[model samples]
Target: MWNLPYVFPMKRVMLMDIKVLIVEDDPMVAEINKKFTEAVKGFLVVGQARNGMEAMAQIPVKQPDLVILDIYMPQCDGMEVLQEIRKQDRPVDIIMITAADDTVTVSKALRQGVVAYITKPFKFERYKAVLEGYRHFKQTIMQKENLGQEEIDGLLPVRMTREERDMPKNIQAQTLQRISQYLLEQAQSFSAEEVAAGVGMSRVTSRRYLEYMAEQGLAERELYYIAVGRPIHRFRLVRQPEK
Candidate 1:
């Protein structure tokens, strides 16, 4: 009798440690942020600062590759720090972390060169998604090959197609791609029943595809409550394998 040989997949090696600096007033929040950054394989937290003043002092010495900053703090705020860094011609990338829901602050932060923004009380998965997006963007920029604006935009994180996301172990690529395109065009989260109706598949089949994607971390499932009936589950494409 002939036996099949086992093939092991190779693990991906990160090129370098993506050094990070945390600037948050709350020690607890800073610790949590640090833990999350360390959990990701390629990133490392090099320094932590309680305020903008301390952050300025550490940036030159630590030379972090990225900065996770809080907008409001004693001594100095995030916007002021960003201005100072710009004046000093530092190349460190910044991602703003804020608890405030104010639109004005968000607009200013974007204009001030924050690469991304995250509101407080976010899940680990959401945090991972944004960081992964940023990583991809940076990698694309580093590539010396000529590229178009559309290609550059493609490097940024956007909603995934249903097919491009997670799928069952045994799914036809054509069908998956079609389903993904349909999902991407939809504006809101879809129920399995709705997806089935839209895709011309059975409810069970639609649900299987959605559950597979959710398991793969390519999509997110949210529960909706109704006054008259049981809660309904909705699915949305939120992530995909890094290209």
Candidate 2:
């Protein structure tokens, strides 16, 4: 008996890198973002812009799949850039990367249509998660020409009100994400002060995020003491049960 070789038609994968634009007023920050984007697997940093005016000009020339935008800048700000892009009917996705967390600004950005908003002083893991999520989203968008309700929901999740997303006031979602990233990398328990130093934020800010995670069961919190009158609080990531 002779066996014939069967070569099934493989599912084609588009290997082309997703082009991206870095739009931040800070030169050093832009450089860091460039390096970070380059380090990611399927992304290519196509161009960099230092100001909103520059970003406006480069958006056309670069024609990026995505733009990482900073909210504050000279000449024009990120919000302005986003407005201009919409005004011109550009189809590029945007992720707001800024230091501003005021509700007014955040609400404005959400209304104006940002794929995501990340605060400054975020971890590499957080950045990586954003890009990876976008990668999944892009693939879904490409593969599905017409999406059903479930598919649409999977691609662009149903929008929850700001209250739902921000359950506990005084806690920034971005900061919580940074803390989650820290937990992912650390096996040893840590203090809020240590998280503050590690993530370049204040102890109070770090504790807020840590405590919030504890409330959500994303992290475990315990009290410990070392030659002190008062007990110290420590935290570690919680292990989730397998499906």
Shift in Å, residue 47, candidate 1: 0.4
TM-score, per-candidate, Cα-based: 0.61, 0.62
Candidate 2: list runs displaced more than 4 Å. Answer: 1-9, 157-243
| Model 1 Cα lDDT, one tens digit per residue, 20-83 | 9999999999999998888876788999999999999999999998999998999999889988
Local distance difference test values of all predictions, in order: 0.76, 0.78
- Candidate 2's TM-score: 0.62
lDDT of 2: 0.78
Please estimate how well model 1 matches the true structure, expressed as its whole-model Cα lDDT: 0.76
